[model samples]
Target chain A: MNTSKPAAGKAPAGGGRETARRARTRERLLDAAYRQFCEHGINGTSIEAITDDAGFTRGAFYSNFASKEELFLALTERENRARLETLRDRFDEVVAPLGRVAGKPDPELIEGAIADILAVQPDNRQWCLLNSEFKLLAMREPQVAPRFLESVRTFQQELAAMVDTALASVGLRFSVDSGHLTRLLLDHFESAMQEAILAGAEDAERAVRDNVMRTLPSLVHSLTEVRPPGS
Target chain B: MNTSKPAAGKAPAGGGRETARRARTRERLLDAAYRQFCEHGINGTSIEAITDDAGFTRGAFYSNFASKEELFLALTERENRARLETLRDRFDEVVAPLGRVAGKPDPELIEGAIADILAVQPDNRQWCLLNSEFKLLAMREPQVAPRFLESVRTFQQELAAMVDTALASVGLRFSVDSGHLTRLLLDHFESAMQEAILAGAEDAERAVRDNVMRTLPSLVHSLTEVRPPGS
Candidate 1:
């Protein structure tokens, strides 16, 4: 068996031209859907709007994806992967010996991660904004709700692991509960991002920066206090 | 000077049965709108859906509110007032000593407020649900964003004032970044509410209880610990 995959743009399956055409159509749908969702919200924008925006007939939409809900799932996965990649890149650059703040938690490390998240560019903003709206849409619609819930739980767990590692390395730790605190951190950052997107002006970034700096210290202290457990 | 003017349900200056009927129709419109917005989201369901649900002509939609956005503003005010009232009630019940645990911040006060917000029955879920969605809606459209921002700022200030008073009563004589902390707490709780709504099967309230309980001790310690400004 030839395990090595062909290079990009090479068709591996039975459908060559059809696969290429489907890929282009799929991108078109996602692009159109994202813009529509941003403008009118995920639940508000219809398949008609998506197809119209993509300049494709309804058949093109049905051929590319089964339904609007399917497209939303695809968008969520696509955006989540992109966001994780962005965070991973930033996290890679933040490595240090905990430097001068060796004994205590590095306020710099935590704040830097937060600032890095805040610093992702405008293109990422649209994806984030769309993903958020998709989450809200899924919450109300029973049809799409289950898939979103699973993905969110997975992300929350991943965040929890990162928090757990950070706390352990800092030599301080949550005495009573670790998982709860991690969830709080995730929730806080998500809320901050949603607020910034809504605020939309240049000042939006400042709001996220200020929020991260303010709340993160308390979280760090709570996690890594190194104080006696019962004190 | 008929300063009393006319009741909401009463006939207006021209004082006719038609005026009274219009009032009923309008109230129905508002109720139906808030209900739909909560269930389907602000952008999800259309004017036709709202009108049909309310059993009113689509023309009647204009008769009541200027636009969907205007109706959303009304929903925002109603929800804000309702939430604030509930918060005030929780505070009233906290008393002084019972509000604080020996080694913790007065999170009983904060916890009670959250409990009040979270203890909604299935019937009342709409207000909480709609409140979250329209809050985001308020942020996306600049015209409606101020009302939501104002509501959040007001709640944040209220929490700060509550904390200040609690500290005074306990004779803790401490302060730290009240404004920033206030925003953090508000963001934390609001985000928690959003998660609770989404995590339909999971007991989010339990997690919230844990999160608040864990954070309270650090808050108290920070409050009691005093230091020289430049030391």
Candidate 2:
């Protein structure tokens, strides 16, 4: 209710320049708001805090985002999308060995994906700060919680699909419970991420990740056990 | 801090009766406090709300709990301990049938454990509520953050010890990263609990758990991979 309404401005030369400037201001506010929210939590954060961090006026904040809630929706969407792209790219970057290149996934590729998330994602302190604090912001504002969960679902589904495809191609699958394996893997990644976030390198997230790759061979073996007649 | 300090009073004639009554009062307050905290969060609920729920007065709240922070810490410890006991007892109850006696775990034992947690623990809304909101409280006052992390660590270590003993008895030992595996398994249980608590069985939580006993065989097989003799 006490939020700005979107405007449909005329498409004039000055209007175009104003649109571009507005986009920049929005991006700045988003970045600053993200950091603040991650640290201080969403409710704990204020419009003034966001504007101050971004070095903009409160007018500019309202001009860019309708409300604090809308900004968070944007942040959740943006973060998930960006992280997904990064994960896929990490997978695509590995240069598999000549022999293994024909079929098996390069360990480097998978390991890199795990390592990259461990290295670059906000530290556990920030994540705990976010999880403990800011997640409430998403749930309190009805427009955000389901959408946020949907985004997570989309990611999980896509990742599951990718793993499913990989296993199928390799003649490895599980009829007993392929779905369970995929969910467990997703859960594994999330748990590892959380531990990595909280304990930092003391958990040696990267090292455990290396072990994760070794587990994959056993995974492939299990798949062989449960795969369809010809899969 | 006006909380009953464990031995706050003693009735001369019938100390046993007074002690029993006081113990019951403490338990009632804890139960009410937990329900309130789960719904509202540590910061969201107050002494007033707790007392109202527990059928006590403001003065009674003071008599039982020294401070809001102290109550919160106590509630957290109580719930976590209870959860561990629940998980452990469930595992113990199922071990003979699932692992040793059955030659391997059947779906029943594992499914039973998962189901018990879902049924016995707090509802989805409450758990998800904590998942969403507790992080903020943890961040604002990190003095207890270590304790939270320690709780998780202790759980994982205890689980690892149980796993180690189980595998040893079976003449199958964890050669892979047992620590990570323990963390991973515990994480799955917790994640499933949260999912059950949150959106309510939206993902593969049930399906995955249904075959937890079955899938675990293949998993344990994989974990037996030999680590090189000595690097």
Candidate 3:
């Protein structure tokens, strides 16, 4: 309640130099905020620090975001949106190799493709740390919990739909509920990555890749190969 | 380098009223620190706040702990020890009924027992959040990384040994390396519990219980039942 209200005049001007400059400044602030939050965590960060890191003053930050909380929430929204887009792009990137084959793809090719699809990003540890912190805060803070969970559900639903679409492209589908399996896989992949990341081995990526490849192949195989005849 | 050195003259007196008093005071401080850390997190908490909450002064805190980091490390050791003890107790409690019965135990009964053993602890969300934060810090801070990962490895090894002993009690064993399976199962169970906890449903515990009971039974059955013909 002590936070500043949204600035009415902060909206981007239509097809003007001011709009382009405003957009650049906003992007720079978001980039800086992301790095700061990942490095120092949410509570350790401040509005002034974010603006300073972005080479801006308090006025610039206030014009772009109503408050630090508002900025963090916007970052979450942006990250989620970017994640969904990446999931789609990665799905296509992984599956494109299998398109060379005709009907019903070979299981090994599918496994490799899925493994590629699941490979850990280099900065995954940073992202996961910040994400878990946000999640913990959202769940514990009653005011934020409902909207946070709602957004989570929506994100999961969208991811599941994308998974279904990706599967359909290959004439495959989960014997289990697609959404449930997608959520489970997402959790499994993240947990494995977290363990490997924390372990901090020389081959951390390989640790994650190997685990995902080892476990998910059988899971995918069972889902596709063990379904009962149609009811 | 700015962190306090390990305190001198902090060692407990040899088995007397003095020693008992020191032990009691240490326990109180740790209890208060755990609550504070869970509520405010490690970085958000301070030595003064911990001492104040425990009804002690800075002199008392320094006499007991070298620094805040030292206190946090001690708390981690205590939590890990407590968790291992709980695992043992829960395993025994769940398996006690089965011991009373003769002949091959019912699969449903075994599944139920395993499910009970794997159920999320009541304070799981707080513990998981703190643990994640510790892991994140350990990964990012090179100076802390080695000791932290070593402790983690030791904990996992001990837990895997306990799992082996528990399974051997029933003439069961993991088909894969017990340590590998233990690591995988730990990740899976923790991830499921985290998801359910974050969902913040009215029946979050039940949601976690149902998911564990559903996914883990088949996993346990497969791992135990599908061993090689010889071993």
Candidate 4:
């Protein structure tokens, strides 16, 4: 609850100092849980293991989060939020140079934007592993599936909005639904990254980057068209 | 061991009757493991659970496979081989009527072929879950990664060949690497299925079918071209 700003100086309600301290505790627990979940997986990891890794007591974990699943949901939200923020920043950076360009953006510009957005994820391998684990867990647990879908939809919408704004800045828009296009790009990027990691390639990062760079530009070129004037 | 032809009357190498019985046992164990792995997970399901589910002793399980990881590898091979066979049959069905087309096949023909190929898998949900679980396990386990990648590559190559043959039959070929194109199609198809399952949609199967139908044809169209006559 309200763990987004762990380092915030001021907090609302429930006593300022206590709330900030609690947020810090939750944040630390989430950090440790992310590492543990990525390394050992969700079901394979236990509450005690996460708490111990976080340097907290079981009581602390229970107080901060009711269950490992609850903690996982929180972590999912945090990671998605952070990723969206990075994408938003990267989108802005990619668009800031082109302020209302005439006609459609050049293929190079679109390709550069795609590359920048893709490169925003720093820990691709760990995130890919953790995301796949969470997905499988959600698929098995019916109770968690809807919540997982909600989080995914939220992230997709936010990223889609950023993509729309970025493309609109360059007088280009997707021929298909923006959300669908975003999902396709995200799926392909993750799949490529997963493949590279599974292959245990020495230059997995570069290989994924190159693969996406090679494949996605043409895809983007085909899926997008110039935004018609006078909507 | 040679578990592919479990029902084969004649066996190579060892005693025919004994080898046949062993292959049958291994096949049963794999079937049970597949169900168990999809229901629970690779890490969560014990070998005893698998053996018990197969109505066999733990000794039988060990005799057939060295470890759960080994069993998983074997299961992966079995599944991929089965899937490729299905795709091959489906491809042949889609192509047999054409009778060696002169120019590029029509868009509808291409789309129908894709739909048939995509529909070849009977249990999309189970395979999606099991495949994701295995991929995550491979990521965490170093020894299994290479073997996993090998299975994936073999599958990809075989599927690519089917794709190439199908396209060539219709006087069309991929502008991109056929293997990469096959990987992309498989990745998207699996991603769509996984999303539908995760969303708990009542018409999950239909939704995945429709999503791929809408998105992939254009992708395939853009990625393919008429095959050069002389080449």
Q: Is the docking of candidate 3 incorrect, acceptable, medium or high quality?
A: acceptable
Over B36-130, each residue of candidate 2 has an lDDT whose tens digit, in order, gives 88767676888888989999888877777787766765666676667667656655443333344423334454455345544444443455455
Steric clashes per prediction: 2, 8, 0, 0
Model 1's CAPRI class is: acceptable
How well is each residue in A107-137 modelled by candidate 3, as lDDT tens digits? Answer: 7977988877766244565677777777767
DockQ for candidate 2, please give it.
0.26
lDDT of 2 by residue, A1-48 (tens): 756544556466667667788888888988999889876767789999
Q: Tell me which of candidates 1 and 3 scores higher on DockQ.
A: 1
Better of 3 and 4 by lDDT: 4
Error of 3 at B46 (Å): 2.5
Q: After superposition, how far is residue A171 of candidate 2 from its true place, in Å?
A: 8.9
Highest DockQ: give the candidate number. 4
Count clashing residue pairs in model 1: 2
Question: Candidate 1 residues A1-231, lDDT tens each?
Answer: 877755667866656666777898999998899889888877689999999999999999998789888998887776666666665565434423333264555566656655665676345445556666676677677677778877777766765666556445544456545665566666666667666666665665567667677767655544455534453
What digit string (tens of lDDT, one per residue) describes model 4 on residues B91-196?
Answer: 8777754435556556676687777766766777778888888888897788999899899889988888887887777677877677766777777788888889
User: Which has the greatest TM-score?
Assistant: 4
Give the worst 10-residue stretch by lDDT in candidate 1 chain A: A91-100
What residue pairs clash in candidate 3, if any at all?
none
Regions of model 2 farther than 4 Å from truth: A1-19, A55-64, A95-128, A139-143, A161-186, A189-231, B1-22, B52-66, B87-93, B99-125, B159-179, B193-231
Clash pairs (backbone) in predicted model 4: none
Write model 1 residue lDDT over B1-231, tens digit each, in one string.
666755677665657667778878877877888767766767787988889989988788886778888877766666566666665565444435433555444545445544543453223345556766776666667787766667666766776777556445544433446665566666656555555556663655565455455654444344443223343
Candidate structures ordered by lDDT, highest first:
4, 3, 1, 2
Clashing pairs in 1: A44-B43, A172-A224
TM-score of each: 0.71, 0.69, 0.75, 0.84
The TM-scores that each candidate's chain B achieves against the reference are 0.65, 0.66, 0.81, 0.89
Screening candidate 2 with a backbone cut-off below 3 angstroms (N, C-alpha, C), the clashing residue pairs are A124-A197, A132-B135, A132-B136, A133-B135, A133-B136, A171-A231, B98-B105, B124-B197
